[model samples]
Target: MRDSIRLRTRARLAYTACRRTRCSRGSLRELSAVAVLITALSSACENPLAPELCGAVADQVVPAGGAVSVRVCFNDENGDGVSLASRTSDGTVATVTVRGRVVTVTGVRGGTATVTVTARDPGGLSATVSFGVIVPGIVRLTDRHGLMPAWSPDGTRIAFLGRVPETGDTGDGSIFVMNADGSGVKRLTKSISAVAPPAWSPDGTRIVFTTRDFEIYVVNADGSGEANLTNNADWDVYPAWSPDGTRIAFVSDRDDDIEIYVMNADGSGTTNLSNSHGRDDWPAWSPDGSRITFTSRRGDDIDIYVMNADGSGVTNLTNNPALDLWPAWSPDGGRIAFRSGIPFSADIQVINADGSGATNVTNNPEYVYGSVPRWSPDGTRIAFTSADRNNTEIHVVNADGSGEATLTSTAGTVFGDHAWSPDGRTIAFSSNHSSSGFHVYVVDVSFFGKAAKRATR
Candidate 1:
């Protein structure tokens, strides 16, 4: 059975690569680095010398009690290496050095190393190739506080809500910003309640977010000129920017019931979309600005709904008995992710754009309180906040519901709720990241790169 499966996979990949490059049977030998995926297939066929146990062309010998790097090559024409770094069993990847076809692994206590590689074409066809390495423990991203994280478009900076604990009489929340590596912490906003959910504009220059009272606001990237975009007495929260940065959409309760609304870049020309007598909150715009997905209680249960930019053709994309809210549009605009179930026991769920194939990505039943599922710009993964009061952390998973891992490790601090950068590389969220108070913080997920190569770096 394994042999047949391997043969089928190789044949499929060979056929795909052949078709993509218009290569004839004889051209297979002439082409280098065909981007064909090879897993646990045997080497009994042609190229019998190819390494099977390691999933590469050659293997490295690590000295006992010492560490060494191993490199793998997929194509000869592509000078770039496969770059399958070290990964923990939980799916966090460690940083690796790539030199041509060789990847160096450090700190080897002598154990099997397993990693995955991914490649893509212009037509969106991709493949994942897995290989194993022997090494010791690999470092990963750990949570500091349960703060909301947002990555910068370029993956350089993360804007998040930082938490400042009450100091004697201080009871205000602040906004915090930092690099993806959790260094260079700086406070962005100061207030009495909370300044949460700092979302970067497409250019990464301005941020649109909400204050504790649910007033929409924007600020410069350097934490200056914080201005309230919506000075309304009612709630105006969850601000999302249009793909083109010309408009912003958010959920407002100005009409008594929560409704979706859009406004100009400078916070003018506000227009309501849902116009429903029921409640609707959490408006997430598609990458193209053609549609918006949000959470609404219009039906018997809280479900996900997608509507045209003009507020026409509203459709409930998720109709499950379990409550669904906090719908986040994928970067490709093909999927919507949201939190389902009651507050204390919610789970992260995703559905197709047309409201089909809704899957529970995080099947954890250990009181998984989820919120704000954001997709990577590459559309390969989603990040969300998961918590159970005592512990809160940012978690990421493959779009197809695999390779789940945690990003934060801070205990006692509550964390979750976020927005991805336009490039799908960073996440912005609100949390009490530190004892200072509750503030906004950002995290860069660019390090993860892609699922096949996603390991802590």
Candidate 2:
């Protein structure tokens, strides 16, 4: 009934208007009468057009501490004055300022921000164009295939290995020290071969790195007081300092088989901890300095083993048939994260410190063999590389294989070991994003995409 009444009312109004206009011969005659009525009803004091806004704005990507500029405008035919301004919805990611028709956005930190450019006219008409300004969370810090990034204990400086001057692209790299912000990169030693992850002393005053000549060398943070810890080395690599800074555990093949060796901080009193018959490498000390975990191949399948600090009480941790390598101890010394499975299809798994309760954290089996598991300083999350197709990405997940998040998605990109900052805010690693040269890179963990999440407790 309501529908029929509304239809009848509309028909009656149309017929009345058509008759009142006195020219209802055709549909065009009635339409002309209605046009006249519209002109009469419109406000005579207003202009016909509001404002024509500029076309869509493009998304802007800027590095942290960098700035970019974009232009926007409005077209108003009313002869009214036009004014423009820009604002950012998230100042922590980016901030914007407007000058005339231009809008300049500066990246404050990693993440994404929404920038809105608004234009207004004197007739109370406004037009706006909104776009995103993104600051990449994973930023390339160094160039030319920089590898082996290690943060100083103080977190104000970073020690890494990268191509040095005069070496060009032909040489491997050398030890380097730089400010935490990627500035003040100074070469600390000569060129090296068979590079390993450098270790910084607990006191933040010394750095231990491997050289090309199969020797372990220690130098002051300022590139002085260089000393060969293993003068007659037979492939000594993976130098890691103990928790108390009294001894350094490293991998050496001096004996018939590769074994883990510990030496005093001053390059004296070297002792072999792993007297295994098979390969042994990647030594990591527990937090309390009472135990060391390493990759060993004493049995048919490679596994992880933990031994007392004084080279006693060796126990197998991962009893898997596949190869398990790159053992990294959690900060609290309660768990260890390592890479498991065979090549081309490996997963990162975490096992309890006492060699029980093993859980696979990265179930994806596409990661390359180099995805070493690194635990955050808080020991709540594990960061590793995940490869899909041919591209590898950095990803983080909880210890129990939950809350997985991708930190990087660069195509055809390979990565190195991950080093967590002491404060657990950023992760340092190596990437070849520049195409020509691999360099050191840092990724902000707390901020992933367009927003920042509170740290996982």
Candidate 3:
């Protein structure tokens, strides 16, 4: 009986030890009740942090010393707030700062980096996501057929001819305006048959363009107040605004032949400036508004001609037997840049304002043709379209005929009609790089080292 009593005591000690260690429950009902209590506490906690981010994250490209903000959202599953943190994989390329859930990344140098964002809960649970950032040498502004990109006088917007997606008809194009970086694209005209790219007024308030019906129209920058400037049935095209915004020079065939004409800003006082027998067209104005330059087929071959604003003192700038067309005046009005030779096999030539000392700025043997040379605002470099046997690309050359470089090298692409921003920091052009016909694109000119080469002649 004493041994049995000792055994019972030892059993009691063992039962106490099992209860302390949570290894045994007295009954099945007790065990189930304890489990229910633990599950209730866990349900109350409810995993306060969510696994997925709530906001949109996009890969970004910024210039050196530029900054962009990225926002992310994290939902708290248990109705409690959370905190977010961010880190950059390469701080030398960019630096990140987190204020609440928004991460601001500033480009520090030229490279690429990855940014990771973490969302954390009070219970020490967290989740992470990452995105890429690139400091690119070139940034493509548009992905559609954007032709003839003309920058606004203020340099904040660009105007171009956008080819509408063809439904069933062949000719559906309109004028469009967008930011310099290819954002905020707004259609400035409805479905109209635009024949040329729109030209902005000196005041940046209005745009002038020619339609396929050979009519000159002026529309407000906001796509309002569209009025036909030349309502005549004749072909009135190639509208250019005078530097002072007081007059518009255009090409018209009203007198049975194409000639240069100038009118008041309100489309009044229309007078023939280049009333000649040969077809005179493609008028460009001097920056000082003292003269007008145009392409004419008056002599044995087509050439560039300059005349006074009032149509007197007509002088041939390029007396070349080969074709010389599309005379673009330099920003300082010191030189004229034009294209020589036939289509697809032309070279860019620059001449003095007084029709002397002409030089071939792009003497490239591989480039069969160069079209429409546009001088940068600083007049140091000229941008034009060069075509080889393979494809056409945009090219830049020093005004003195040195340091010629192909700015674009896309295969099977054709690029043309480039315009420079007022500050000469960027160039806007049209390209078919995506095989979708023509779309406008803008590239950072700063990436092309030393764009400022003075005219040698």
CA RMSD per model (angstroms): 16.3, 10.7, 20.3
Worst 10 residues of 1 by lDDT: 44-53
Which candidate gets the maximum lDDT versus the true structure?
Answer: 3
Pairs clashing within candidate 2? 145-437, 145-438, 146-438, 193-212
Q: What total of clashing residue pairs does each candidate reach?
A: 51, 4, 7
Residue pair clashes in candidate 3: 144-439, 145-438, 145-439, 146-439, 146-440, 345-368, 346-369
Query: What is candidate 1's lDDT per residue for 110-186, written digit by digit as tens?
Result: 33445554433322333444544333221212243335566777777777665554445343456666766667877
In the range 1-457, model 3's lDDT, one tens digit per residue, is: 4544454455556555667777745554455555555444455454344545675466555545556787877776655567888889899888999998788987776667878888887776666777776653445677666788889999999998877655555436688888887899887777567878788999999999999898999989999998889998898998999999999999998999889999998899999999999999889999999999999998578989999999999998888788888999998999999988776567888899998898989776667756678898888899887777877776777899886655555554555467888988777877666656677766666644522221110
Q: Taking the tens digit of each residue's C-alpha lDDT, what string does model 2 give over 1-457?
A: 4544454456557767777777448865666566554443342233346667747666666555557788876787655668987778899988899999889988777787788877888767777778876675877777555887899999999988776556454445578888999989888876344376678999999998887787998989998998889988478888999988989999898987899999999989989898878899889999999999998887688999999999899998888798898898988999999988887788888889988998888776445546778888778888887677766667778888886666654555655677889988888877665667677888887543334221110
What are the lDDT figures for the candidates, one per model? 0.65, 0.78, 0.79
Ranking by TM-score, best first?
Answer: 2, 3, 1
Range of the 10 consecutive residues with the lowest summed lDDT in candidate 3: 448-457
Off by over 4 Å in 3: 1-136, 165-171, 342-344, 448-457
Candidate 3, residue 52: lDDT: 51
Report the alpha-carbon TM-score of model 2 versus the true structure: 0.69
Q: Candidate 1 vs candidate 3: which has greater TM-score?
A: 3
